[model samples]
Target: MKNKPAFATMEALAAVLIIGFLIVIFILFIHPPKQFADARNVRRTSNVGTILTALNQYIIDNGAGPPGVDGIWRVLGTADSGCNINCAKKIPTGIEAAGCLDLTPYLVPKYLLNIPSDPKLGKPEITYYAVRQTINGRIEVLSCGLESNQ
Candidate 1:
């Protein structure tokens, strides 16, 4: 009967609406854009923590700060191409202040296998992180690129 065809058309429409609802839920709740930023932030925090831990362990083992100095902010990456010969050294970036501290000698293959970089916008040469010793001799590590505004 004609009613049977209309019923079938209604069933198809209902199925399509259900599918649309599920897709909306998936996009809004299961895979929102904010989740990606949050994940990057978590990675940044982990990188900071690992750097701090390695720096602390080095101090405990050697009985002295790695830099052998205090109260200075040292960027934790290689100098940019602009530095020319000083490329091997750390240079300032937008994330942190001037002065580069290459922890490779102090941390590489000893405290950490190698220095870790930012989850994004970081390379082996320029870790988007910085480390400094407070005037009181406390070591502080920070991530230059933190996502999620956190």
Candidate 2:
């Protein structure tokens, strides 16, 4: 009788351990770590800040902002043709632009070596966007990245 009780206790413990292990696996699958998303968001914020700083520097050096007929220069190329100014119409989504901006005057090896693409480049639903705001005839660069929202 003593041996039987010990055997039962051992079996119960083994079953509990197995169940715990299974639960852990299930949880891992259901709720994967969000580190990747968090990291991407951080990168997006950094990239936006970098671009904004470059734009500010460009303005200081040139005494005027980049050329834009309507004061709105969409970053990146257009979605369909990846053409910057030649695109038929502008799309609001930042990820769809083929190029970063038409501010070539500012990018002559001075402002930025290369434009920074979104961390999630191919995912057009989320990307970096920039707009030049003119207040009192002074140019201000405003930017937002999709990852920041996440």
Candidate 3:
């Protein structure tokens, strides 16, 4: 009789442990928390679109594209990026060494209040590259439906 009770107690403990594990799994599936990875991707993508639109508006208001590479000329002057805070060194074009320019300066006259940042990009900064175009063979604001992986 003593042995029978001991065996039953062990069985009950095992059953309880199994049930607890199943419950944990169920909870995880039922209310999935936002993944930082996915969140960062969404933010980065959306920000790219938003900034692109702002660039367009800025250009429409102004005559030409912002100075320097990637409209980053704003960084040298102590102005705001309007999308987010970017003290970016100029994006290189064909390995030109003097190509150090911050991309924020192009969106002038309040293009954006604050720059959108990628959550996963090590410091909540944008990691996408800009595509610049020329109007009548003159450089203008940035453009990007498909950007580079910088």
TM-scores of all candidate predictions against the true structure: 0.75, 0.56, 0.48
Model 3 clashing residue pairs (backbone): 72-102, 72-103, 74-105, 82-112, 83-114, 83-115, 84-114, 84-115, 90-101
Model 1 TM-score is: 0.75
lDDT of 3 by residue, 16-134 (tens): 99999999987786544445444555665676677667766766787655555342222122222332223243332322222323446566438865554444432213233343544
- Give the distance in Å from residue 1's predicted Cα in candidate 3 to where it truly belongs: 19
lDDT of 2 by residue, 1-150 (tens): 335455578799999999999999877875544666677667767766776777778778877666651245455422444423232222344323345455544554688776666676523322344444455654443334343244
Candidate 2 local Cα displacement, residue 86, angstroms: 19
Model 2 C-alpha lDDT versus the unseen true structure: 0.54
* Positional deviation of residue 54's Cα in model 3 after best superposition, in angstroms: 1.1
Ordered by lDDT, highest first, the candidates read: 1, 2, 3
**Deviating ranges (above 4 Å) for candidate 3:** 1-8, 23-34, 69-100, 122-131, 134-150
Q: Please, what's the RMSD in Å of model 2? A: 6.8
Q: Clashing residue pairs, candidate 2?
A: 76-99, 76-100, 77-97, 77-98, 77-99
2 versus 3: better lDDT goes to: 2
For candidate 1, the per-residue lDDT at 37 reads 78
Would you give me the overall lDDT of model 1?
0.71
